[model samples]
Target: MGEEEVSNKQIILKDYVHGFPKESDFLLKTSSTIKLKLPYDSHDAVLVKNLYLSCDPYMLNRMREADASYPTPFTPGSPINGYGVSRVVDSSHTSFSKGDLIWGITGWEEYSLITDTSLLFKIQDADLPLSYYTGLLGMPGMTAYAGFYEVCSPKKGETVFVSAASGAVGQLVGQFAKLMGCYVVGSAGSKDKVDLLINKFGFDAAFNYKEEEDLNAALKRYFPDGIDIYFENVGGKMLDAVLLNMRLRGRIAVCGMISQYNLEEHEGVSNLFCLVIKRIRMEGFVVPDYYHLYPKFLELVLPHIRDGKLTYVEDIAQGLESGPAALVGLFSGRNVGKQVVAVAHE
Candidate 1:
């Protein structure tokens, strides 16, 4: 037959944001249309129907002007893109075909035409929830795995601390530390999240950082002996406090600093001297650098998921229309778990 066409709805970035982001910072465009087939000359292109879009803290960096990063800045009038789970509707790539499920970096729209398929991963083990590919089994999962296991070099019986402990990445890190036989303590912004970290995730102890009058004292109370390993997710004040409480020769895995993302002038940590005095080893890592370990990570995690040894919580926004509000909510600690925007079911 003939080429099919359909109306494409998208969440577009209105402009570069200053300070905290708002729903109005993004525009929902519903008038666009796209062909459901690749161009005749299109080489290795994949046309996909986006099923779910991932709302991650890292996307905030992409909303700004282009930087020296894997994802460049989003164009002012174009669709805002991030990691997503999609079904292949059309493809010219050798490894993909119609009806196959895939997850990767995709546009924030009903449909997307992806030219670079290097980052795209064909979803295997369809028996699990497809939305898991947006967080638990996708980028965030890999991030938690890489940062905790490789960067932290965690040992059994060590005292571990995680900031933003109930977040997409931090929750998994705490569980992994528990699995390693470590004493894991987590810090969250709310009492509800603190309870989730302690009760649901099996963390040894958790505290509401928002309620803590003095963060340094709180860390001391949890880790009286000092922290052997720290999974740093929140930066600024928390990092400074953790620095003071770190054990000698401690290891710190520097993941995303969500606290500094929206600030015009990022908050400075005044505890660098702690690293020197404590002889601490601090390293910052990006997930893509460890993408090669995905297969190995799945080998270790999938069994735990099946056995109900690991738990993942997701906060899903209903539709493409909910994208802006959901994305903006990350900064305010409004989301309970991994934030996902459901664009379509299939």
Candidate 2:
């Protein structure tokens, strides 16, 4: 018997992106190969067969060459890296053994040999769909849970507003707020997504921000008494409007600024005075900063999912080939829900 060869399909970044990303900015290359075994430096490495790859807006920032912060930027000639769910085929790590289902930072290929086992979470409840790990149970789920309960300090009957309502985190936030007996409203880019917020996700009200000429007027229409909390996913103009409509001592949890990600010049927020006038508490957050809270989040959310008290909608594109389109689609509002690429099913 010889070492088995595996065809590694990858979505490679074409070049360092300057502005908005296009499908052409990536190449679906199948010229790579991998051996199905751990190397000598595999003290904590786990070889995994990737299943679902999450397409999140934060990935756009990673494509830039300027932001050289933690995790670094995605290189020009490497696979487009993101969070994914996978099954461990081989492991040299103590925490994970062979055949264990795990989810974390894996490459956009068929097989990923992960060196960073620190972030990988073992899937204890395999009864739930593995695809859920890429969206609902993974980073986005953690974002929604932490941003709403931990950050917002939500109380019963409080008015909460979410931007990008039909998105991965936004949908879950709305659901969580509803469970807390809070008045929840969300804004989406399209009427379809708006309807999903109200009809599907049980939001108190929802509106298409694209149709609203005056966002302030729209906010006033929905939150007549003003917003008690704002879960910010889309930024720029939407953020400005929410600032003006916030109640005194309102809390704001900023998880992302999808609207300003690819802009040549970022939009300046002119609502600083509104924050001062309202005495709103606005804070930006990164998901990795709160990974320690994953166990707590899972305990709170998993039961709701099993009992159907909470639901998740995913806009899945099939195969590694669909990876490029899915990644580019996040900024264009092309996906209806949480955009995911199903690399392989197992």
Candidate 3:
């Protein structure tokens, strides 16, 4: 199939967006003329058939014009790119061979030639659902593990608070904290999500933040002694309240600010001064920095998955055509769990 042509259907960004992204911002186009294998002289490149594509919140930032912080924007006419689970069709790279199952950054198209394999993680166990590479077993898993174990540094019986607690990273963080013997409570967007956090993920308690009038009061009610660790997922108003509720010397790992991503003017966190007075340690982190811990993290997480101690939920949208709606659903809290776009199931 090296030289044979295949129609490549891609999700292309129409233009840079200003506010909340509509499905119309993306166009699904199919091209019959394409290369299905790594091109000649393509040093360290692998051609892959994408199986599952992750629809994450951060992808929204990439759709907008380049910012001072997020400088890399998706090319207007090109296929949008994000984390994906793929099966290698052909390779010029020594590290990867044809038929290898790998997960990393790839084009939103049906087939993608990945030039840089620096971030690619080989899928070893074929028994597990390959789609896990897009969520629990992939980037979001590493994020939850590192942010909770390495960054937060929890102790038994401590109080932990997680915002966006029912979503991918939040659910995993909540479960990890619970396993560490900490009292964990998560905040979700709806009653169903809140219930899933407590019943499914084994969170100590959960609440719908959308129903709360005062976030500060809500935090106070749950964490009477104040939160020892705050897994900051939703920034803006949530951050402001968490800053006020955080106990002295508490740690806040700022993984993302989904609330502020679509805004033209980012909302200010007014309680930042509390960090100084409270001796609280608040730092932002990107997941890629902790990729080195992948093997060890898997060792720690696998047993929990094997036994009944841990569970993960995913909202899968079938096919490349569903990419836009699936990705956009993340912002509005339409997705119940980890949002994954299934291209071709194995």
- lDDT per residue for candidate 2 within 217-290, as digits (tens), equals 99999999999999999889999888889999999999898999989899999887988888888988888888
TM agreement with the true structure for every prediction = 0.98, 0.98, 0.98
What pairs collide in candidate 2? Answer: none
Residue range 57-168, candidate 3, lDDT tens digits: 8888898988657637899988999999999999888889999999999989888888878989999876778898898999999999999999999999999999988888
Model 1 RMSD, rounded to 1 decimal: 1.1
Please tell me which model should have the higher lDDT, number 1 or number 3.
Answer: 1
Please give the distance, in angstroms, between residue 100's alpha carbon in candidate 1 and its true position after superposition.
Answer: 0.8
lDDT of 1 by residue, 87-112 (tens): 99999999999899999999999999
Query: RMSD in angstroms, candidate 3?
Result: 1.1
What overall lDDT goes with each candidate model?
A: 0.93, 0.90, 0.91
Off by over 4 Å in 3: 69-71
* Residue 137 error, candidate 2, Å: 0.9
lDDT of 3 at 311: 93
Badly placed stretches (over 4 Å) of model 1 are 67-71
